[model samples]
Target chain A: MDALKAMWETVPPATPDDLARARRRLIEEMGGRRRLITVPRLLVAAAAAAAVVIPLINGLGTPAYAVTKNPDGTITVTVNELRDPAGLEAELRSVGIKADVSFLAPHTRCAGPRFAGVDPSYGTRPHTEAELKWGAEHWRSLQVIKAIPAGHRIGIHPEYIRPDETLVLEIRDDQNPKVLWTLGAWLAEAGTPVKPCTPVKD
Target chain B: MTSQVDADDATLIGRSLDDPEVFAALFDRHAPLLHRYAARRLGPSEAEDVVADTFLAAFQRRGDYDRGRPDARPWLYGIASNLIGKRRRAETALYRAYIRSGVHPAEIPGAQVEDRLDTLAVNRPLARALLALKPADRDVLLLVAWAELSYQEVAAALAIPPGTVASRLNRARIQIRHALEEGD
Candidate 1:
């Protein structure tokens, strides 16, 4: 046993480069948070001016997004006063999510959010009535119909959301805007155990 | 550069929430020993993957870490052990290869005549014994013998009762002793 221990100890130690590579990997994983710290700090300082000033120059078509956690174990994401969709896309990027939002005129009927289904490798699959019903019944189902405001319209489709994840999205009407509705979607992945919804405060 | 090197694992893990690089100190302290242990079982290439994966996973789950445990060796080793378990086939193959070649690639063969002969005789049988033992028993025995973890530490690492570790150790030791005797 002692000899075995000694023999094992003789194995080569990891080189400095190897350690550096690992540290690099960790930094890569932290890319989102780092951007949040830097970009948002600047954006927040400019937000007041941008909120009031940008509207005059950019017009009322730019979209701004704020993600917040509600007391009811739900997420409230307000995509408001949109002038350009790029700002909303950037905010989603800060949170390590890729999303696209397009605003249409009032009363324009829009399609629902697209999902990659359970198997992205096989390509997109349409949600069946039973599947849609099951998704709705699931605790994390995204409340699409309810979250959209009465006058303002948008289509939401999740191309990729990990399994055992619930995505909560809230959208409000342009007039007297308040978080009137929310969608909770519990995404199920194949061969993975369902995870309970973890309320995320954005 | 950070004074965090002096801080205990629990403290480092707690501080990691605010300053992530603080956790790197923990990796610096533990990774070499972890790499050595994993290399013993899975060789150097796989050991690199195991060590990297262990630290990355540890960093991610630091939020859920039990801060009461000051020394993080057991927790870290436990994570490494789980990763090692996933590559059990590789581990068994390593032992089988050692038995066939009577050469442990990582080991520097002994210089003296008697030491070299003795090592050759014992290493093959040890490799055979390790191969023959159940995974659980081998884990307990190797952790005690090679990693030098105490019975209590072994219990903590494997998340088993101390009594269970003792029983596994006893059973493994008997088999190893018998294997050595047969070699003699």
Candidate 2:
């Protein structure tokens, strides 16, 4: 251990010239212009944006879902759930999309301006069939089919859905909206049917 | 100097963009250590690239730096580790070559005969032990031993929890000690 420590300590220090060259190279890379932003501030800004946007827009009840285009030009659907999160989670599992869900409160607002121009007041509403349908319509218009809840809300945020793939169903306690279940399955790339979520028993 | 060191990584990063001198300072502070670490894993030839790539990436991503930490070595090392991971074949080959040739690419200059031999003996076994460890564990171990980073610094570099750092270090140390004892 002492030898190891000594060895580490004895390692040659960087010379002033080495630093100068590094600075020169960095300056060249910057096109002879030094950067104006610091990394931490940038990270803070990014994190702030992600913290706000991801929860609000990407979280639950928004109209966008991730679509993965397969090598054969086919697309795969994924849904993100925020409302009735547990239910959507179980559904995702039945469909073989291993999902990990977290419950986020609707009132939990993040700092910064919201992107997508959708009103935050719209996000605060309770989950209703009309709202879900409206979300679906908007998502469809945007070419998104799969929906998942992003947080512990009443809305079903679109995660991802293929065009023709079947929806997996795993719902628990049909009578209680608070109950959690899951739905998952592979569907085709277009004109896929929106299946009703069936509740599962313990 | 303390203020400069105490300045958040973000502040330094911002300075780097407009001030060529600041970027050079950052590089001066980090490159030698990064180079030596890379040299240990990859020969001197590839080590330079790793160092260069690390600083370049840091430059590009300076805006995303977390200001909570002032020092940037951990972050730079993390980037270097990623670059090193991409060249896994070369790194493994270098270590295997070292084991065969009984030489460390980053061997210090003008070392005593016994010290050089000792380093070779310890490091050869250590290399094999390092090779045996999971990539994550090896990363933590080397950052501590070779890079001299604190556990918290290693966590920052790897974007892992400090608890994870402790566990990885413990596991890696066990393997290293075992390898040394076995004289492999």
CAPRI grade of model 2: incorrect
Error of 2 at B98 (Å): 1.6
Number of backbone-clashing residue pairs for each candidate, in the order shown: 23, 59
Could you give candidate 2's per-residue lDDT for residues A10-106 as a string of tens digits?
Answer: 4454554534455445545653231111112223244454432222224435543333444543334343433455555555555444333333333
Residue range with the least summed lDDT across 10 consecutive positions in model 1 chain A: A32-41
The parts of candidate 2 lying over 4 Å away from their true place are A1-11, A14-24, A32-202, B1-10, B17-21
The complex in candidate 1 yields a DockQ of: 0.12
lDDT of 1: 0.58
C-alpha DockQ for predicted model 2: 0.11
